[model samples]
Target: MACSACGSDSAIVCSLSDEYRDYAPADAAVISICTHCLTVDPADATSVDTGREVEPDFSRLSDSVPTRPERAIPLVLAIDLCSSIATNRSAIESLLEEVERAGTDPLLVIDRLRADPDVEPAVDLERRRHQLEQLLY
Candidate 1:
């Protein structure tokens, strides 16, 4: 395939090794990218037979595996709380009720300077509701 960005023909068909190893049949098509301009070259690519079989390596399983260390990962969940409240209060109430039932602590972060201090909690709740609405509809 020609370089999508520069339209260069001097491209090499490279195998997506990582993708192939993680998820894909051995006989799946090999995706390639241009080496010169680093653009995806689909035309020059070809299917490769990986020749993988159900052969398990039992040598490495003799010893017990070590426990993995806890790591922090970013997680973002968008909910249409605002839209639910505006369009259907029952749905919003149901979601909140479920959250309460699950005993999950919901953390809400907001720009304090831009919000009124007296009604900061209310504002935050409203803002979150609006964000949820945007995500849903």
Candidate 2:
């Protein structure tokens, strides 16, 4: 995947893993970041081993995005299991299309999507939309 920060095509995923020796919380989980951008992502973290047994490292990769994306690179990926909008590809496509057309607030587009009468609001629409909004920003 391309780097989120520098937009470099050679970007990789790395872990800023916590060392238990530091007395970190028991609930601590691996954090995955774009090695090029150092942006933390939970979604990517779960897709791989993370290999962050004791400390953070970036020398390996469990997977990679096919290549550089043509548009709408996800800058702020939600590491949590809360991104409903990601599954709603049609909604995402419409939203991105509108954003391209208006070149204005994508949040407004999301609000409109949430308010659309034909669309049955997902139980977690607001929260998922918030996650999607973070991606746009």
Candidate 3:
């Protein structure tokens, strides 16, 4: 459905099961937000075709299982670790300096922050570091 505010067809529609505290309606109410203007508006629940919704295929779940299970890292922790590498020298360093810092291994923190330099802000830093290294060479 097109957004009423911006008239943009590129809008995100979400189905809410309950009221969103003076924002969304309750009882499976549909809301649309314009990606352009970022306006949130109530949309007609009937406007969405519920029949087109994809059902989860449980047949794959019964299929072959991997011998080794993959470990999933929490998003918040990943973001925090990335942030520590990105802006910690300017932000967290000052905050950490006040206390009698002890028992904290600097190498451990360095290892984690540098572990996945290909991820996000770390990638940016890694690219810059590579450029600087090239210049030095």
Candidate 4:
């Protein structure tokens, strides 16, 4: 179908991926995004064909939105956290002591990594964070 706003034939309608379902409104069952103008329109669950699963053009979507490297945020956060630990031993020791009470969980580790002040927010980073949050449950 042609996009309503941009009149682009590159309009793609697809069911939201499970990984990204949380980003969509709870009521949105299917969504259509125009590749040319980058307009997103969500539709009722009944609108999509259940048998044919079409993947949205993620590269196009990523191009239009600001994004961080998907897997690198955590690694970068970890490296930065370690750097902080190396440079500020006293502060690190205090924080470690505080967190020691909570026990060590991988999800908690990710939460700490995500909360780092240096990790700037971006569309891709939020998407990855949500995906990870869902997986942990």
Candidate 5:
């Protein structure tokens, strides 16, 4: 089956893989994983959030906007997160601004989000951080 996170045609559900690395926990089901993403560390740029099993509880961050992630990589992550969370258009526009902006490393953007208090349970931020790891990185 295709990976819900990266659209890769290599996603597979492993009953033997480490549960600690599972992405989602759909009710009574185990986690699904992709071959490519399962290896990339979330701390790395080319990372896919392999262990996510549920929709992140980002409701608390509905109003906690992240800083504009400029450059290519950061921009991609920001845009992906915005789209995933259905952030307001105005906020998106502001986030796209390149004022004093610079590089595109995914970690930079992840770090920015890490600093934000809205992203509860550090794993939530990691989930979004590598949301596009397959496509971009």
Candidate 6:
């Protein structure tokens, strides 16, 4: 794959672990950016270990042991915008509208968006607007 920043042919795929307890997952994929020019090299991306602990199983415990089941919580989608002219507002609004129409909770929507190459300093307002339009309406 070509670098998103410098258009370099070299790139690596990388994996990452979720950091937050709420949104954390077992693992995730990330593209490595060039250290020299800060260019995102998708082809050269590599996975990085986050060292997160794995969930333990307690089904086979002794009869005297006390065990609690994991709680199931509503899903909350996370939206992020890149430098392109786009945002997540429209997507969220459209999602809310769909939920209302379907008479379902917004938690049913499990979609999330993030910057492809990891935008720096955040995307501009115009870009956010465009992103919202593209994602939602």
The candidate maximizing TM-score is 4
For each candidate, what is the lDDT? 0.30, 0.37, 0.34, 0.41, 0.35, 0.30
> Is 1 or 3 the stronger prediction by TM-score?
3
Off by over 4 Å in 6: 9-14, 19-28, 36-81, 85-137
lDDT of 5 by residue, 45-123 (tens): 1233456633322222322322321243223323433444434333333333431245334455545655755333213
Q: Pick the candidate with the highest lDDT.
A: 4
Q: For every candidate structure, what is the RMSD over all alpha carbons to the true structure, in angstroms?
A: 17.0, 14.6, 15.0, 14.4, 15.8, 14.5
Q: Residue by residue across 1-137, what tens digits does model 2's lDDT show?
A: 44433454433333332421121112234334444333433334464554544332323221121122111122112212234455644445444444445443545534654565543322345666666565555
- The digit string of per-residue lDDT tens for model 1 on 1-137 reads 46555565543332443422222123223433333322332332233334642222211211111111010000001122232345545444444333334443222221221233322121234456455444334
lDDT (Cα, 0-100) at 35 in candidate 5: 35
Candidate 4 weakest ten by summed lDDT: 71-80
- Candidate 4 CA-lDDT value: 0.41
Ranking by TM-score: 4, 3, 2, 5, 6, 1
* Superior candidate under lDDT, 3 versus 5: 5
State the lDDT of candidate 6 residue by residue for 38-84, as single tens digits: 23222222243447533322222111111221211111112221332
Off by over 4 Å in 2: 1-104, 121-124
lDDT over C-alpha atoms for residue 13 of model 5: 35
Candidate 5: what lDDT?
0.35
TM-score of each: 0.24, 0.25, 0.31, 0.33, 0.25, 0.24
Give lDDT tens digits, candidate 3, residues 50-135. Answer: 87763222122112111111101111112222333444333223222211143332323323434433222222334334332232
Error of 4 at 112 (Å): 28
Clashes of each: 8, 2, 0, 0, 7, 20
Q: Candidate 2's C-alpha lDDT?
A: 0.37
Ranking by lDDT: 4, 2, 5, 3, 6, 1
> How many steric overlaps does candidate 3 have?
0
lDDT of candidate model 6 versus the reference:
0.30
